[model samples]
Target: MLIALLLAVATVPAGQMFACTPIRVWDGDGPVWCREGPRIRLGGIAAREIDGSCRRGQPCPRASGIAARDALVRLLGGARGRSGTGHILVTGPRLQCRSTGNAKGDRTGAWCSAPRIGDLSCAMIATGTVLRWQRYAAGHCR
Candidate 1:
């Protein structure tokens, strides 16, 4: 069942709406694994890599990678556990997301809104844990 869900969501066309229940969060900017099977990279923002480095030419916030990641976990209802592969499990509300399309690798690029958190990308930036990356952001952060 899960594999079927994954395969179905593997190619979300741009501007499509999808539901997400965040199960694990990898960082402030995301790769937020959803129970519905898509891995979402929060559209319009960038955070430090796990090693505290930003990709070249991207907007880099001053916060460390761990700090940024922890902030996101909290916003997503906090960490409940950790997956064996090191992803931090969370307890966030289901999100309503609009796919911008597939991102680098297998993740989807999307703008997601949580019940209380509103826009995940804007929320992350409001906290200063991440920065808006214009190239991919496409004015979504405004």
Candidate 2:
């Protein structure tokens, strides 16, 4: 029993460790994938006109309907494409972050392909750490 207890204790720390996981972001309206890179654009559109807050749980909004795509592209440095996709596996204390989606009709509720650390998604943004746009896949916007 002593040996078993020791083994259990040894594994407890491992359980606390959080590793980055691969996540996929799909364009809400279609199969298009958001992209990442040095110069990102969404549907060949520049991100200059995009608008919205970067608060955790808040859906990143844009002037055009393509805010989500543009935000992702800018944060991760890539373009929003129909088939372009990338992953930002979070690690360490950042494991608290999570991906989220917007509820229909609410701009702040839009889906986050990759959230910061400790944020979750529901009809509304949760309390705690918030996430900024950061990562993308490849493909054209709908």
Candidate 3:
């Protein structure tokens, strides 16, 4: 299933191409959106609200949302830095992703991530605080 998901990502045509530049991470669950090309969502998982707290029962951090955002930045930063040439082609869901960003109102966008490193939603889930969103997943954990 994972392999199938990975293969779904759309790529550049025969001769044309675009550079995956610095992605400005959004304040919420979104890693903002990629630039110069296709927009993607970090499939499965959704980020905690910027002001959203951790699990209710436990004593969460002062700014858990910020931490998640930072973690995402670090993850993407590492991947971006590793590449010294053209675009990184960070793979992402080619389906359902909004053709353009509309964060504030309708909140329609797709998730994405760096090559071989995996998707941002997965990384955030590995953090233990986040889980796959119910809307896009079959059970809970994919």
Candidate 4:
């Protein structure tokens, strides 16, 4: 019994170690979406609410998808001029969105759950002509 208990205790910490980091949608324009494993992040229709409803009569902006992709690439520390892809270590879902006012008006947005320590695709809504992003480290659970 003593040997069994000791072996179990030794394995606990190793089991807790995560292989993948949680990546959550921070913010973006259009219909923002993401996928894990061969990660593909895309921006969809521009919406005014959390449910992703495209505003009526609002034409898709030429720079919308570019803006979203730019935000993700910057967070991952990828090259500005190159369009290649690579893996990024994202640990949590703590994200925020800020927007620059365009000729029309200021945009608004939000995200769902906080990221967990696992593989996931994150997506969110964003407003403004310009979008900014920042990365945060995640804490271990007790």
Highest TM-score model number: 1
Tens digit per residue, CA lDDT, model 4, 36-74: 211121212242222333346553333444454445434
* Winner by lDDT between candidate 3 and candidate 2: 3
Runs with alpha carbons beyond 4 Å of true place in candidate 4: 1-37, 41-62, 78-124, 127-142
Instruction: Give lDDT for model 1.
Output: 0.87
Q: Tens digit of lDDT per residue, candidate 3, span 13-128?
A: 22222234434554335544445433343445655556675545433434466566656655665333223432232322222222223323433344444564455566667775
The superposed Cα distance between candidate 3 and the true structure at residue 12, in angstroms, equals 14
Cα TM-score of candidate 2: 0.23
- Estimate, for each residue in 58-141, the C-alpha lDDT of model 2 and write its tens digit: 334333424443333233334423333332211112112111222222211212233532221220111111222334212212
Instruction: Return the top candidate by lDDT.
Output: 1
Cα lDDT computed for each candidate against the true fold: 0.87, 0.25, 0.45, 0.28
The alpha-carbon lDDT assigned to residue 120 of candidate 2 equals 19
Provide the lowest-lDDT 10-residue window in model 2. Answer: 34-43
Clashes of each: 0, 30, 7, 5
How much is 5 displaced in model 3, in angstroms?
A: 24
Collision pairs in model 3: 26-32, 40-110, 40-111, 41-110, 41-111, 41-112, 42-111
Deviation from native of the Cα of residue 73 in model 2, angstroms? 1.7
Model 4 earns a TM-score of 0.24
Using lDDT as the measure, what is the rank order of every candidate, best first? 1, 3, 4, 2
TM-score of 1: 0.91
